[model samples]
Target: MSAFSLSQALAWIKAAAQSIDANAAHLSELDAAIGDGDHGANMARGMAAVTKKIDSAPPADLAALFKSVGMTLLSSVGGASGPLYGGFFLELGKQSAGKTELDAAGLAAVLGAGLGDIRRRGKAEPGDKTMVDALIPAIDALAAASDLAQGTAKAAETARAAATATAPMLARKGRASYLGERSIGHQDPGANSVALLFAALAQACA
Candidate 1:
């Protein structure tokens, strides 16, 4: 699709919820290796709340939809993920305010704003072995895309790859940082969740 509308946005949210639910165990497994083991369950809970809130009330506008999702995540999720993901979506809503649909460039702008908010909230850099590793590269890929579908697909690929790359990096942030060199062999749970988010977006676009 050349443009993303409310329907597509809702689809993206649903897809994200489903993906998180499906991979909840795997996420927790990943987290158990390096950080706290609640990442999977927490993310699944937050996404489910977002889905329920959106389905029950049904946002009147695109911005409202994203804002509702953000609020739901903030209220439902736990740990650092709650605020980080919530802030990201809130920034997305802010960037998309007054717009009913987003073209390629609009999508890029929204994603970029979300990434910036995430970085700011987490005080994370690309090599920090945090979600930023996946998100920054995904945003870069999206920025070069010509349309929503292409952008989402490219973002998914880059995000997954970035998440994989995190396996070899020593943690420098969050709970994983406490592991020191021991963190190098494990994949970051937050990065994996980010990859799933982009993958869901790509599936929605498809």
Candidate 2:
């Protein structure tokens, strides 16, 4: 088995932060159409804080690493994203307890755990115009892949497509839901961010 190293995992984290930073404006622009117009900024700030936390504390294992990211986002990010995204990572920490590296199956478990918590906390399902839209499909793709190489790449692709697909979906959760029919044409910023992070994961592993 080709084990996914701790270094690769850390690289994924850093890359995710960088990706979010780069796409902050675009994310916020997407949010402006259907949300409070601050998702990009909020996520950028939260990811930055998570980076600092990682740099300063440098967690010892997968569990601690994910925990630091989750807690940092919870404390630093504003709005509903703080809890939803933070809870996702926290669940990752819980599932990853006592480990450093992951095989294909282990990676799937971690991702599934994260998605499970997001669904639980956000009360969102697929096509909800939320991150759940992208995450659910991505995790499913990852779980079905033959290995990490194929899995991460396929997950990223699936998430990207799912995010794009959200544009036509009616909002059923979160602030976007408040808009009802008006939310139908706009893409979900949260789903885009989920897509970006998944792309970062694929890149880091490649």
RMSD to the true structure for each prediction, in A, is 0.7, 1.1
lDDT, candidate 2, at 55: 95
Q: For candidate 2, report its TM-score.
A: 0.97
Candidate topping TM-score: 1
| lDDT tens digits, residue span 1-206, model 1 | 99888989999999999999999999999999998899999999999999889989999878998899999999999799999999999989988899988887788789899989988888998799999999988988988888889888999999999999999999999999999999998999999999999999999988
Judged by lDDT against the true structure, how good is candidate 2? 0.90
How do the predictions measure up, each by TM-score? Answer: 0.98, 0.97
lDDT of each: 0.93, 0.90
